[model samples]
Target: MSANQLNYSVSNAGAFSDFASVTEGMLKGKIFLKDGLQLTSMEVSLNHLPPKGEVPFYHKHQQNEELYIFLQGQGRIQVDGNEVDVHEGTSIRIAPDGVRALRNTSATQGLHFIVIQAKENSLTQWVETDGIILDQPVEWITRSSCLK
Candidate 1:
């Protein structure tokens, strides 16, 4: 396939939403053109949670690393069993083996965040977040079968 066939983009405002209920709470999610774009080794989405909503499970990836950038309201992210506060402007990076989950703690506003997942050991650079970069490679062993 041509490279042009592999490249596609969508605006958040134009994306369609999907809903899921998990142990944490109700999730209103908008996937970033996964089917249409035919992405490989990467995934992106926007998640919005009402007050007191949360992701039900602590999940880990064996081949993919994840990054979450908080966009609105407030929430708590549990990473490796530790709960950390997150709000607008907060960014988090989770390696493939790190167990992670999220909860929306905001009472009046929704908790909105952008999630990006890429293959483990991939080079990632952020213009913001102090120009953060990740370049180290890791050989991750799966804890169990992935349910993703």
Candidate 2:
């Protein structure tokens, strides 16, 4: 599908240049902003790190907290001097002021991850309170099943 569709956008991480090509102190991923995603409250990026590579510097944000989700390979993330091992399915959340750095520890596999950033303490509602049940039936579900 095209990067920007009806109400959403989709793009692969591989579409962006390698992390090694990113300049120092810059975000090391394909930010959705450049894809015309029209995001207003948060920023998302798809990141890939070469095997045995590491972010050259530790950094922190001033107002945006970050969540890192590891999707492939092995890695280590350091936050405020504490290190944690991460691999596929691993996730870590860091507050705005928490200094953080990452490294790809695998000898032969690249690290694939996603980073989501948003203003801290900005969420006022969660799934239970924010979502409303709709009476409309889903197209994928059989009509007879709705009666059950």
Candidate 3:
């Protein structure tokens, strides 16, 4: 019988830990690549607004499917001209060419969730948000909640 070859290391504690200071303001992601692990699963632990909090641009996928699993916190989901409220323990699936965006309405509390890009050669698309002017850079979540 032949044997397979595989080796890896513990990445930033190997598993999930208390994301207090690590995930402060914008969205922070820790890649497990340098840790020497295969890309078995596509996962991201999102804390805070993840760079562009309230004003997330609306865009579509070129060739990938995405899903946002709300581990904790609350937010609203806008898809294909429809808006859906998302909360903890909720998994929202988005398809290609589908319009999508999320906004955090909490005051002090932040939204914690895992982004699962279930498609290969596909990346998160936020090129043209719904109401965003597309020329000006979004400062921060100036609005209380999502418009659409």
The residue-by-residue lDDT of candidate 1 on 1-148, one tens digit each, is 1123224533333322222332122344544535445666678766777778787878899898888998887999998889999999999999999999889887777777788999877656556744656798877767685222
- The alpha-carbon deviation from the true structure for residue 87 of candidate 3, after best TM-score superposition, in angstroms, is 1.1
For candidate 3, lDDT tens digit of each residue in 31-118?
2231143346453433444322453478778766777777656678799989887778999878867888777666665666666665
Candidate 3 wrong stretches, greater than 4 Å: 1-9, 13-37, 40-47, 50-52, 120-148
Q: Which candidate is the best by TM-score?
A: 2
Over 117-136, each residue of candidate 2 has an lDDT whose tens digit, in order, gives: 99999999989999999999
Q: Give candidate 3's TM-score.
A: 0.55
Best-matching candidate per lDDT? 2
Q: Which candidate order results from sorting by TM-score in descending order?
A: 2, 1, 3
Q: Give the CA lDDT, 0 to 100, for residue 114 in model 2.
A: 82
Give all candidates' CA lDDT scores.
Answer: 0.71, 0.79, 0.57
Better of 1 and 3 by TM-score: 1
How many collisions per candidate?
Answer: 2, 0, 4
Ranking by lDDT: 2, 1, 3
TM-scores, all candidates, are 0.66, 0.78, 0.55
